[model samples]
Target: MSDTTPRIETERLVLRVPRIEDFERYAELLADEEACRFIGGHMPRPAAWRRFLQMPGAWAVQGFAMFSVIEKSSGLWLGQLGPWQPDGWPGTEVGWALHRDAWGKGYAYEGAAAAIDWAFAHLGWTEVIHCIDADNAASQALARRLGSRVLRQSGMPAPYEHVVVDVWGQSREDWQVRRSTRA
Candidate 1:
C-alpha cells in the first residue's frame, strides 16, 4: 500500500522490485526473439539496457511498476508481471511477460493473479486490464482464465502504436466474486 514497491509472495513465486543485479537475466528475456515477439521484437543489448531500466524508472516515477518474478524454489528469475500504466495507456493494467523457459508451468497465471489482487486491494483500482496482442492466443487464454473478457481493441503508445491489441479486463466487484468462488 505504500508508495514503494512491495515484495509479494505466492505459494511458489516471489514478486519484488527489480534490482540492477537482475539486468543480465532480464536482458536475456528481452533479447529472446520468441519471448519478446508479442511484447516487442528482440533488441540489441543497448536497447535491452534501456528496456531493463524502464521498469525501475516506472517504479520511481509512478510508485508502481512491474515486479521481477523469482521462482521461490530455485531462486530463478522468471520474468516481470504487475501493474503498468504509461502515458496514453488504455487503462490501468496488470500485465505479464515470462521468459520462454518459464512458460508452461502456470507461472504467468499465478503471478498475474497475485498482481491483480494487489492492484485492486492496495492500489484502489476498481478495474484492471490486460493489453494482449490480438494474435497472442496464449495470452488471450490466460486473460480468460483470469476472468477478463475483451473490453475493446486499442493501439499502444508510440514505438508500438502500429500494433493493435485487445484490452481484456474485469471490475473489482467481479474479480472479488471470482476470487471467492476460487476459494
Candidate 2:
C-alpha cells in the first residue's frame, strides 16, 4: 500500500532511499557549518537517521517523500530533496538540501524537477509548495526554477519566518504532452 518507489534518476543525480551506508556521509554534511547555515543547526548522527527513517511514513501518508541525492558518476551522497506534506498545507511541497561542496551546482534543480515531474505525472498531485527562509536566496531561486510562485511569507515552527511558494502542476494530459515533447 506504499507508493514509496526505489531510485529515481535525473540528469546528474540519483534520488533514492537513505541507506545505512549513507549515515556517516550524511552526518558529515549535516554537521558542516556552511551546509547547516540556512536550515537546522548540526544534527547528531542518530537524530539524522531518525529524521531519515521518518520519510517513508510521510510518503505513505502523503504520497511523496524526501530522497537522498547521489551523484551518478562519483556516487557521493550530496543530500536530500522531494515532496513534503506538512500541516496547513493544501497540497504536497517540494524541497531540497545539499552539502556545501554541492552548492553552486544544479543538483537542487535537477533533483527537484524530477520529483515534481514524478508527482504530477504519477502521483496525481496537483500542486507542490516550497517553504524557504526569507534569507535563503539559493532556495528561493530553486523554487522559481521549478515554476513556483510565492504564496506568502509565514512563520515556520516558532521562531523563523519562511516565504511560502507554490507551484501548480501538470495535469495528466499536460504531462503526456511534456513527455512526448521531450522524447
Choose the strongest candidate by lDDT: 1
Q: List the RMSD of every prediction in angstroms.
A: 1.8, 3.8
Model 1 C-alpha lDDT per residue in residues 1-183, reported as the tens digit of each score: 344559999999999999888888888998899998898899888999988889989988888899999999999999999999999999999999999899999999999999999999888999999998888999999999999999999999997889899999999999999999999
Overall local distance difference test of candidate 2: 0.71
Residue 146 in candidate 1, Cα distance off native in Å? 0.5
Q: Which residue segments of model 2 deviate by more than 4 Å?
A: 1-4, 60-63, 87-91, 157-183
Model 2 over residues 1-183: C-alpha lDDT tens digits?
234466798788998866667777777887787777766667787777776666666766655678889999999999888877666554566677788889889888888878777767666775566766667778877766666667655445433334233333334454456557767
Estimated TM-score for each candidate: 0.96, 0.77
Candidate 1: regions farther than 4 A off: 1-4
* Superposition TM-score, candidate 2 onto the true structure: 0.77
Residue pairs with colliding backbones in model 2 are: none
> How far in Å is the alpha carbon of 8 misplaced in model 2?
1.6
List pairs with backbone clashes in candidate 1: none
